[model samples]
Target: MHRVAVLLLAPVVGFDATIAPTLFGTAAGGDGEPLYEVTTCAVEPGPVASTNGFAIVPTAGPEALDTADTVVIPGTRYPPARTGRGVEDAVAAAFARIRPGARVVSICTGAFVLAAVGRLDGRTVTTHWKYADTLRELYPAVRVDENVLFVDDGDVLTSAGLAAGIDLCLHIIRCDHGVQVATAVARHCVVPPWREGGQAQFIDRQVPAGDHAATAATRAWALAHLTEELTVHTLAEHAHMSLRTFNRRFRAETGEAPGSWIRQRRIDRARELLESRDIPVDEVARLSGLGTGGNLRHHLRRGMGMSPSSYRKVYQGA
Candidate 1:
């Protein structure tokens, strides 16, 4: 069984900490047995007060994280008082004990603690959009993203505010096991089994309750032909707009040019090929429609700041 330790701080946002056991508890292993063993731990040993009116009694303390297969930090209603100074020291010490290759996660403002300890240094991460700017100011080494619901930077993961915790935990299940197990877990929770895109994917479109976007038919049609040669002309044709008008509408909806959107997706696809297969660079380039490895290398570096081999090594390490 995977032992998951959720590190709860004083004045904790009770909901974010609970998201772990609530989601991880639903996972079943091969042959259908329970898969994960989860524990709630406090920064200190006794009862820790929550942002909610009530408080919780943790079974263990920071030391509990020493043996955790995965350690997660959940947001607190008050990030500073509880997670500042001494609290930060305790959290860092606990993190130091984590076994190599063990996973670490943060929910909402809890990412501040992870970043404080340098876990997210040189990494792309997200928090509640409201706090994105503060996170960047405080931790200049961390790349704060204001968009996505969550970010999976290998073993270290982070999520957006409040209910996005559910999505982050679901993603963890998917990462540890496979899509099937996570889909089952999501089914049990009665949430969407899968989300379609990253934070950028949701930016221009109006997402319904708990979803990321409401992309119109134009986008729906565009997805069917991502790998083929596509252009602004073709997209304008599909949307039935003249070039100038279509460009304006697309920008208003998605916050980027049509060509830029396509390239982002193509680069995302190219990374998948690099990480998932041993195919030659030429095939990956061809598949992503970048035409050549040199172009792929240039764009990949521009977007992620790492070469294909380096990205594969870092990501595949997990």
Candidate 2:
């Protein structure tokens, strides 16, 4: 089993702290064995206060990080981390204990801790949207993009606030295991299986008056009919709006252009088919509305840097 060490620095964001363990711990293999061993550790083990008006007692200290395959730092209110002054001596020592080459992850304001330790320098990362400006100002070396739900930069990954932590954890599970396992974990946890990392973060937006003027129904319809050619014009017609009006409304709601969103959905469908079915590449492309095997290859290579066969081999172990 992969070992995961969650390092808590009080006062932590209670919700963010639980996301990794909840999602990773719930993940099991075909034989019903846990896929990961999750341990909650602290700089000084014992009672750690949370920002949520509660405290948690951890069973281990920084030593847990030494053998971890991944080290996760959840949101923390530690002054040095939050202010970019530098990490506390204990926290710095704890980070040093992480095995070389182990993946490093941050949830919400926990990016601050990573940034303070220079782990995020020159790397694109994200935190809560409200704190984007502050983070950028504090650490100009780190490129902060608060618009996305998370930024996955190979070895280091950072997620946006609270609920977005769930998204990132689910994403990690999918990457490590496969779509089926990730989807099963999400089902067990009662959350959506996946959200694209590039998908925009939820910000306040003016809702359409009612069902009549909203693009939600049209979006749902498009998802159900992904095997069909879905063009912006067709979507506009289905929504009973002009092309320009539909485009404006769709972008406003989804933070992506209509054509882009359609293509992404088709790509997502193709990936699911590749992982779950034993069909030929051409057939998968046709079923996913990508037109041809060449088109599927093009999209997969451009977006994921891999061909369909490679993806299948990796996920299906075939």
Candidate 3:
């Protein structure tokens, strides 16, 4: 089994720290056996208080990092204003014990620890969108892109806040196993197999709810009918609203215009098909409403910096 060690720093974000073990530990192999052996560790190997006024006693100490195939550092609220100035002695020692070639992952502000240790230098990474500016200000060498939910820079991976960690975990499982296993895990966890877009889609927005949740049904219909010819006017008619009102409401509810949202959804669908299915690029494009292979290539390059074939090769593990 893959050994995963979660390093719990003081004032850790309870939700962020537990997600990996909970998700990864529950992940099963084809024969219905656990795939990962997850262990919680700390610098001192004792009860560590969380930011939520609770304490969790870890199972091991820093030495666990030495044997772990993957070392995960969850978000923590450290002292001195949580700035990425320098690594603590204990933290540095733990990092050192992480055997060379072992994957290192950070969730949310846990990127701060990696940044402090100079592990993120010259690497593209991301943290919580709220802390993206701070990370940039502190580490000028790191290419910090706050738009995506996570950055998987080979051995080193960093995810945005909270739930983005789940996405990262799912992506890792997909990378390690395959789409089937990851999709099964997502279904068991009662979450979507994949989110629609990058972290940018989740930026704070005042979305209407209940009866005032205008355009929600139309959006759902559009998602289900991605291959259909969908324009702003069509969506407006589906929502029983004027084109101008629909556009305004779409921006208000989704934090983007209707065309942009539809484009992203199409791109997302295309990516899903590319990763999970063995279909021709032209067929995938037609099914995703991109119309043609050239259109699909253009959008994939612009949105993901990769062609459909390249994305399939990388993500499908083929």
Candidate 4:
């Protein structure tokens, strides 16, 4: 089993702190064996205060970091991390115990902890959009992109506030195990199976009035018919709107233009087929609306850096 250590700093965000243990703890293999061993640790074992007006009692101390295969730092209001002054000496020592090459993750303002320790220097990362500017001001070297739900920079990962941490955890599960396992975990958690990391973080926007004016129905229809040639013009007609109006409303609601959104959906469909079905590559492409083996190979390689066969072998163990 993979070992996960969640390090709780003082005044941790309660919701963020729970995400990893909940999602990872829920993951199980075919025989119902847990896939990850999750342990919550702190600099000093005892009651760690939370921003939510409560406290968490961790069973382990900083030594937990030394044996972890992955270390997660949830959002914290620790002054040194928040103010960019530096990390506490004890916190620094705790971070030092993380094994070299072990994955490091941050949830919401936890990016501040990573950044303060210089782990995020020159790395593209994100935090809650509300604090993006503050993070940027505090650590100019860490490239902060507040638009996306999360940024997965291989060994290091960061997510936007609250629920987005769930997305990142599910993503990590998918990467470690496979899509089916991740989907199962999401189902158990009563959350969506997948939300692309690049999906927009919630931003304040004026929602179009009424179901009649929104493009949600059309988007759902498109998802159901991904094998068809979905175009901006066709979607506009289906939504009973002019092409220009459809384009505007689609981008406003989904944060992606119609063409780009359709392509991504198609690619996602292709991936699902690749993992779950024993079909020819060309057949998977046609079913996913990509049309041909060559096209599927091109898109798979470009998006995932793997051929369809390679992806199947990795995920399906075929």
Candidate 5:
């Protein structure tokens, strides 16, 4: 059986801590045997206070890391005030015990701990999108792609928030088992088996209900005419500004390129069409501004690592 050893830090998010075990343990092989054996290990064997004021007593300590097939770090409240001082020492000792080829994972702000160890150096990684900017600022060596739900750089995987942890665990199950097994685990958990990491984190935003919404109107305008095959030139024209000026201010506010933002909007539209209607694939291409079925397939595979039909099957939510 595959062994998943999770390192439980002080103040751990309890839900994220249980994700791997609950998801992986539910999967079965052809012989009907469980595929993974999950163990929760802490720096110490005794009780530790959780963020929610609950207490946890893990089964094993750092020594168990020496034999783990996989090592996961679940999110916890970050340091400076909320955390105990032993965090650094405990985590360091645990890191030292992990052997090679053992996969490493981080859920939510646990990316901070992984970053602290420098294991994520020069790797494409992400945390909660709200904290993405701060994580990038703190760990300059990390590539820091903030838009996706998670970044899977082979052995090292990092996810965004509590729910995204479920996604990553299911992904691991799929990689270790297959789509069929992962689907079963997701059904057990009552979650979508797969979601495009490229899917927008959130869209709805609220102002103070007083200040004149500037970018809000601009964003709406961009979404209306996605199929027009426009550029920053057309966008700047709508916003009534020169190209150079628009580019600077747009990046300052949205933190993404004009082209990328448009493409993402188009993809979201494509997903909506794919899920809600029986529209043919080529129509999906045209409506989503991807131009043709072949182009749509290419973008879907590159951005999400899945075919359109497969994506619809899981996330259609219909």
Candidate 6:
């Protein structure tokens, strides 16, 4: 079982702190055994106040981080209160206790702590959209993207906001275990199994008033027809709208371009096949509408940072 340490910074966002253990701890293996052991700790052993009225008393201290395989930091009210000030001295020392090569993760404004410790330097990351500009200005070396739900930088990961933390945790479980395990956890937790990290954070949407033509039917049709060639023109016809209008409406409703949405769907199909089926790469590619094994290789590596075989190996418990 993996050992996960939840490191609490004082004034931590209550929701963010709870997500790690709740999702990871609830995950189980084929034998109904817990996959992870979760421990909550602090810089110093004592009561730590949260953003809300409640306070928590941690059972462990910074030393807990040293033995953890993963360290998760939730959002805090610390950064915004002091603009340029970064991690506290005690916090820095605690962070340093994490052993080399252990995965590090942050939720919402918890990114400030990672950035302060120079862990996110020159790496792409995201925080809550409201704080994107501030993070960029304060840490010029860190590449900050405000739009995506989360940014996965291999061993280091950061999520956008409170709920996005759940998304990130599910994704990690998917990568570590497989789709079935992650899906079971999601079903137990009453959350969606997958949402692409690149999907945009909600922006003000201009929904057409009553009786306006919607793209819901077209999207459903496209999902069913993923193995077929799908283009903007073809989808526009199915929706009974001109190409331009379909493009505009699709982006408004889905927060992605029609082409990008199709690509994502194709990737999702490919991932399912890779996880559940034992077939040739070429066949998987053709079934997923990626045209050829080479194309699937390119896209999978671009989107998931791993080859089809590598993904299959990890998912199959090899």
Kindly provide the TM-score of model 6 when superposed on the true structure, using C-alpha atoms.
Answer: 0.88
Q: Per-residue alpha-carbon lDDT of model 2 for 46-123, expressed as tens digits?
A: 799999999988768999999999999999888887787998788888888888899999999999999999999999
Q: How many residue pairs clash per model?
A: 1, 0, 0, 0, 0, 0
**Scored by Cα lDDT, where does model 1 land?**
0.76
Instruction: Give the alpha carbon lDDT tens digit for every residue of 14-79 in model 4.
Output: 999999999999998766889999999999858999999999998799999999998999998989
lDDT by residue for model 3 over 131-250, one digit each (tens)?
899989988888888887888888999998999899888878766765666777899889866653243526465546554448889989999999998999999999988998889777
Model 4 TM-score (2 dp): 0.95
Q: What residue runs in model 4 are displaced by over 4 Å at the alpha carbon?
A: none
Q: Write the per-residue lDDT of candidate 5 for residues 193-306, one digit (tens) a residue.
A: 665555545545543343232344666787887777868888887777678867765655565678887887787677767766677889998988888999889888886788
Locate the minimum summed-lDDT window of 10 residues in model 1: 206-215
Candidates' C-alpha lDDT: 0.76, 0.89, 0.84, 0.91, 0.76, 0.87
Q: State the TM-score for model 5.
A: 0.64
lDDT of 5 at 231: 84
Q: For each candidate, what TM-score against the reference?
A: 0.65, 0.95, 0.76, 0.95, 0.64, 0.88
Candidate 3 wrongly placed segments (more than 4 Å)? 143-148, 201-213, 242-318
For candidate 4, the 10 contiguous residues with the lowest summed lDDT are 201-210
Whichever of 3 and 5 has more lDDT, that candidate is 3
- Local distance difference test, candidate 3: 0.84
Which runs of model 2 end up more than 4 angstroms from their true locations? Answer: none
Residue 317 error for model 5, in Å?
27
Which TM-score value belongs to model 2? 0.95
Residues forming the 10-long window of minimal summed lDDT in candidate 5: 78-87
In model 5, where do residues sit more than 4 Å from their true spots? Answer: 78-87, 205-318
